[model samples]
Target: MTSNEHELEDERALCRYCKAPVPENEWFGLEVTRPVKMPDGSTSEVDVDFLDAVFCSQEHAALWLAAPIPPTVVPQVTVFPRWTRKLQRMIERGRP
Candidate 1:
């Protein structure tokens, strides 16, 4: 691998659950293995080839193990969805 590529890989590690870049100090690693079936109809153990993830914190790790990360909150919208039919209905009802 190239030196620059190696450096880039070292600098950025995304959390497996939230997909957030983990800080240097907050770098947390986890390894996992899974079973897979080959096309030949045989089962084999498969180990992840690369770093599984670098979590932001221990809490995130625990939460990730329990469930998938929830999507981030969207504070605003640029274009109206479905022509803003829902909003229009609410406006027509004189609510929000």
Candidate 2:
């Protein structure tokens, strides 16, 4: 493999939504946390880093959080049948 490819493979972050590989300088690190119960029956915050999730930009982060909008369906309308007699008359009169 090429040197750049090797370097990227060694150090790169994937976008949480699009799964695009992000470089170190461009990596948007977002600290994701979850509530956990402690031994004393108290709630505590725990950082989740299983995926090591990161985004390419803030826009991607927003998109990842927002729900996707569904596509709208349009009704199709067919044209009426042509008038054969009127068309024939118009052709005969050289008006067409």
Candidate 3:
């Protein structure tokens, strides 16, 4: 591949916690929720914007329940393929 030759966008998604790119079959998602006050004046859990966040495992999914909200992306860092965490992990693990 050449610098100008376009490649398919990387289809992989990373775990929200550990940031690992596990297989799709291994991907675990949990509902993003918030406490809602019902008409009866009792608090109840409701999905937040009907969104689901991904995790590599149940452990991470659980941890994410207490993790801080998503971090802001550094625009310059995201532009280069070399800086993506997924690529870095692949290099570290010696995977293609």
Candidate 4:
């Protein structure tokens, strides 16, 4: 087995979120908890449980928090084609 595979087997080397064993070449750190401002202006704490570090990669984390929630769109389905309207009339006349 490769060194990475061996490290994964070690169980102590895994990332808390993805569960992938951390590579030996990279530095690992714990996440820090920060306070978030709610819509009502009250502050709430959000813990980054994965890296245990203050934040994941700065750009990715910032974008994640700042992204707007998408608006909901409902779809309308068309039930009948023009030809099918004649079929509906046939059904109303009790034709099987």
Candidate 5:
């Protein structure tokens, strides 16, 4: 194989949960959109690739998914935040 091809094959992604090296050919994960509240009170949908949190196998992915979400340590403030339609309806109904 050419040097470039060999380099490409050596590329690996670390699994998010186990931190195991996952080769490029064995990368397994999900592509998700995350909504970020901008400073202008607008939300943007960011397309995230598997590289952000890749997995070596489906079991690892499942384990990661089933794990409890940890509380955020960073303090963030969202002023005049943009709310989704469902949340808006819930607010109108006086439901927290």
Candidate 6:
């Protein structure tokens, strides 16, 4: 067989979205952009790209694009102690 075919035979990268082995020919880089809303009601942009793109199938691409954000489990914030709040108030008053 050809060298390209040999390389494809050796390839085993899988698509994160679909869990299928990716082929050599369809490998490509994809740029993803997400829009953000500012406090002033204006829109901003954020973007990221896959370090390496390898697609097992077109369905893999679709699923990755539609994945939901993972949840974060941060501890809840509590009110500051009375003494700390008083110290903060004194500090703020001292500032001109």
Whole-model lDDT values for every prediction: 0.65, 0.63, 0.65, 0.50, 0.65, 0.59
Q: State the lDDT of candidate 3 residue by residue for 10-96, as single tens digits.
A: 456678888777566788888754554454656555423234678889899889878775633222423466557778898899998
lDDT of 4 at 66: 56
Q: Which candidate is the best by TM-score?
A: 2
Candidate 2 minimal-lDDT segment of 10 residues? 67-76
lDDT of 6 by residue, 1-96 (tens): 999977777777777666576665775434544444454655545523224345676666666656763332223556679967887888999942
Candidate 3's displacement at residue 40, Å, is 24
* Model 1 C-alpha lDDT per residue in residues 1-96, reported as the tens digit of each score: 999977876778788778887776766776544444454655545422222556878887777767753432223557668768888989999998
- Residue 68 local lDDT, model 2: 43
Give me the overall lDDT of model 3.
Answer: 0.65
For residue 51, give model 3's deviation from the true position in Å: 3.7
Pairs that clash in candidate 6? none
For candidate 3, the 10 contiguous residues with the lowest summed lDDT are 70-79
Clashing pairs in 2: none
TM agreement with the true structure for every prediction: 0.43, 0.44, 0.43, 0.26, 0.43, 0.35
Q: Candidate 6's C-alpha lDDT?
A: 0.59
Residue range 6-91, candidate 2, lDDT tens digits: 88776776788788887678767655444444546565554222223588888887776574422222235655447667777799
Candidate 2: Cα lDDT at 78: 57
lDDT of 1 at 83: 66
Listed per candidate, the RMSD to the true structure in angstroms reads 15.6, 20.0, 20.4, 12.9, 12.1, 8.6
lDDT of 4 at 10: 94
Q: Which ten residues in a row have the lowest lDDT in candidate 6?
A: 44-53
